[model samples]
Target: MALLTVKNLKKNYDGSPVIRGIDFSINKGTCVALLGPNGAGKTTTLRMLSGLIRSNGGSISFEGLDYQTDIRYHIGYLPQHPVFHSWMSGKEFLVYVARLANLDKKTAASRADELLARVGIADAKNKRIGKYSGGMKQRLGIAQAMIHQPKLLMLDEPVSALDPIGRREVLTLMEELKQETTLLFSTHILNDAEEVSDELLMMHNGEIVESGPMEKVREKHRVDKINVVLQEGFIPDEDLITALPSVIRTEVARGVHHIFVTDTKQARDELLQLIQAERWPLERFEVGRASLEDLFMKVVDS
Candidate 1:
């Protein structure tokens, strides 16, 4: 079931449209990634959904909530650049946020401890926010967002600023969190989305260009292509590969040949026959579908 729905969503600044009319829904208990390059209005969309900013035009519907109601009560948002009270400890900050969310003192303290433990930063709960590492601080930010046990959790570029280790830490946390709550995160990093998300919302210039389950979207854009890697210092003959009856085009980059074809079986049979006849120094050969990056480029460029 859809936990949240949007229709004709739009936003503008000084009459310049940043988010054009776009529509999508978030289903219950699924990890959805909002993907686009910078200036794609991803941040604007998230801000509007979180009720931090009002939209110029559109309607948002959350399950069990009436239209025009404050949906912020059901949403937990962690911005790209979250500010922390440097002097406060992790536990203290969370308790403070819980209190702000309208929890009583005792309940806020209990919830704060529970969340700090949940996000794997319990060991640093008493430590000052100023002393926390990037990863720990991020985990703390997540804990604060969950203080009220929101039905949906939204993160903006959760790992974009972290080091490799920090990125890995947060990504691992996200993988675990998806099992418990619906997740909506925005990212420009394709690999991270591919690794963790079940659904994708590919936006460009304030519109959703592609949106669906990851596998469905990939299959929709799949192409009949073959990749060949010759042994070191040996280059595949592009002219020879392109001459095959089934082959449409061939591109070589760093000794790897990408051959696009009209017929996969015919292309593979013909290529193998030529490789055997010419005794080509083949290191690897595989037939595959187009990658997520390739699909993103194809849609954006089109």
Candidate 2:
């Protein structure tokens, strides 16, 4: 059975709709990425899902029951920018949130340390929230969300404030979390989503533009892209390159021709052999697949 389901959900801030009739479902033991460009309603959807904000229309069900009442207890939310009591230490803050989540005093303290360590902030547990940097706070946010051991965890731009190194750390933690909890995350970072999520929901202007399993989505958007750097002054086979059944288009830029294939894969090796046999001074030849970023651009553009 699906662990969470959103059906015909609609929400508006003031009179403007941010989430317009959104609908989707997530199963247990699965990670689903809510993806979109800025102002694409990703955060709004997450907010409604977590019950931080109620939807003006439709329903959200969790474990096959109305989530607004029952499932609220089963969710953990890491907001894009977590508000903190600057006066409180990191450890204290987590304990407070943990207590508010209904954890017992002893378990709350224990959960606090576990989560702090889980997000790599154990040593800084006593540091005041105001002293922490953006990345540090994001880590704390994640810890607080997970300490309660909620069934469906939602993170909005969880790793956005981190540098590349910090991003990797958080992504790795997220990967580990998936072993035990269902994850629904929203982020502008395409690579982060690509790394941890099994599925993606691409949103635009209050609507889901596309949604599917990660590999399936990539394959759906997959087009062949290959780069060939020729031997200096080696005349290239423009007509022959385009004639390949899989080649959607070919372009020569800065002495390198990029071949985009969309059909048969038979002659890719033969084409290289032909080029090498001619000894065209090929310095580089490599195949490239469409990345989520590539797919994101194409989908949002259309």
RMSD of each: 2.1, 2.4
Can you list the residue pairs that collide in candidate 2? 230-281, 231-280, 231-281, 231-282, 246-263
lDDT tens readout by residue for model 1, 73-190: 7999999988899999999999999988889999999999988888889999999999998888888999988888899999999999999998998999899999999999999999
Off by over 4 Å in 1: 235-243, 273-279
Report the error of model 2 at residue 10, Å.
1.1
Report the Cα lDDT for candidate 1. Answer: 0.92
In lDDT terms, which candidate is top? 1
lDDT of each: 0.92, 0.85
Q: lDDT by residue for model 2 over 1-302, one digit each (tens)?
A: 68888899998889998888988999898998989999999998998888778899998888856524666568999999898999999999999988988899999999999888888889999989999988888889888888789999999998887888888888888999999999999988798788899999999999998898999988877766788887778777688777766677888888878787754355477567667676667788777666888888987898
Q: What lDDT score goes with residue 160 in model 1?
A: 94
